[model samples]
Target: MTVKIAVLVSGRGSNLQAIIDSIERGYIKDAAVNLVISNKADAYALERARKHGINAVFLDPGRYDRSGYDRDILKLLNNYDVDLLLLAGYFRILGSEIIDAYRDRILNIHPSLLPAFKGLHAQRQAFEYGVKVAGCTVHYVDEGLDSGPIILQSCVQVLPDDTEETLTGRILEQEHIIYPEAVRLFAEGKLKVEGRKVRSLD
Candidate 1:
């Protein structure tokens, strides 16, 4: 069975492109991206999807409140029959409506190692806070903020001369790598979450 995926993204969607590339290159096999949805009409991710001949659309949030917005998203997910929801740089905090609807089926990638410097500007937070190690985390999406069980992580050492941009550049590289890895694991039924810990089954 091919795993059907729907990507929720905002902004450039570099991770979205990575997943697409991974699927196309057979790094992540037996999975298809059914739809790509973005809140911003001008998001380049939509363009990336259309360029690949994949279905892509922009959902307007002005027409609905938080739960209503989630309802709209759920409608699309059901419409596409998406098996997995992948969030890539989506800025909005999801409500219980969406979280409960998708539950453990939704995954999100955070820029920091998680449980630290969550939310926006995570790279900047790590840089300004002068952390020696900064990396990315792939985790399940919970109602709480980046409090989900971590599936995979790749670390990038923060050099003494590293600025936010340089550090982010490195972390984004790791993001491209691990995001697909997590998706592939999920597709292969190799991921099990228990008590805030994600176990990888071979």
Candidate 2:
């Protein structure tokens, strides 16, 4: 069965483009991004989706309260029969309604290694804190802030002359690679969640 995916975005969808490219190139097999929803009408991610002939929608945040907005998102997921939800640069914290409905089915990619530098501007947090190593993590989305089971991670070295921008750019490169790989694993039924760990079934 082809896995139907719905992506939520609020910024430039670099990761979204990566997933689309992966699907088109057959790196992610038997999966299609059927829907792309953005809270900002001007989000370039929506444009990326439309270019690929995917169903892209801009759900105005002002039209509804937090809970109501999430409820509407749930309605869209049900209407489109989305099997997996991916958050790509989406800015808002999801409420319980959607989180409970989707639970383990939702995936999010963070700039830092996770369990550290969570919340916003993770790359900057790592850079200013002077960490020697910085990377990206793909994990399941839970109620807590970026606290979810780990799936895949790729590390990048923080060079001696690297600034926050340079480090962020390198970390994002890894995010593009591992995020799609994680999605492919989920599509192939190669991922199993147990306790705080995500076991890859080879």
Candidate 3:
């Protein structure tokens, strides 16, 4: 069974591209990205989706209240028959309606080893805090702020001469790596969430 994926993005979408490339290269078999949705009209992710012949949509948040906007998103997810929802650089928190609907089916990649620097500018926060190691996490998305079951994580060492930008870039590279691996695991039914832990049957 081919897994149909819908990705939510609010930025340049490097991780989105990584997922696409993995599917194309058969690194992730029996899966396809059917839709890419962005809240911002000018998000480069939309353009990336278009270039790949994927359905790209821009939902104007200003046109609806928070619940209403999420309702529209849920509608779209239904319309696309999305099997998995992936959040890659998406800025907004998901409402309970979608959360309850998707539950463990929703996946999010955050820029820090979560349960630490969450919310925003996580890489900068880690750098400022003088952490010796920083990394990214792929986890199930719950209603809380990055408080979810972790699926995969990879750490990057903080060098003495590393700037925030450099650290962020390295963390993002790891994001691109593990996010696709997590998606592949999900597609192949290799992941199981039990309470706060995600187990890999593979």
Question: What are the models' TM-scores?
Answer: 0.98, 0.99, 0.99
Task: Please give, for residues 45-155, the per-residue lDDT of candidate 3 as tens digits.
Answer: 999999999999999999999999999999999999999999999999999999999989999999999889998999999999999999999999998999989999999
Using TM-score as the measure, what is the rank order of every candidate, best first? 3, 2, 1
Which is the winner by TM-score between candidate 1 and candidate 2? 2
lDDT per residue (tens digit) for residues 1-202 in model 2: 9999999999999999999999999999999999999999999999999999999999999999888999999999999999999999999999888889898899999999988899999999999999999999999999999998989988899999999999999999999999999999999999999989999995
**Cα misplacement distance, residue 115 of candidate 2 (Å):** 0.6
TM-score of 3: 0.99
Cα lDDT tens digits for candidate 1, 1-202: 9999999998999999999999999999899998999999999999999999889989999888778888888899999999999999998888888788888899999999988899899999999998999999999999888889899988999998888899999999999999999999999999998888999995
Q: How far is candidate 2 from the true structure (C-alpha RMSD, Å)?
A: 0.6
Question: What RMSD does model 1 have?
Answer: 0.8
Candidate 2 residue runs with Cα over 4 Å from true position: none
Q: Considering TM-score, which of the candidate structures 1 and 3 is the better prediction for this target?
A: 3
Judged by lDDT against the true structure, how good is candidate 1?
0.93
Prediction 3 global C-alpha lDDT = 0.96
- Residue 25, model 1: lDDT of 98
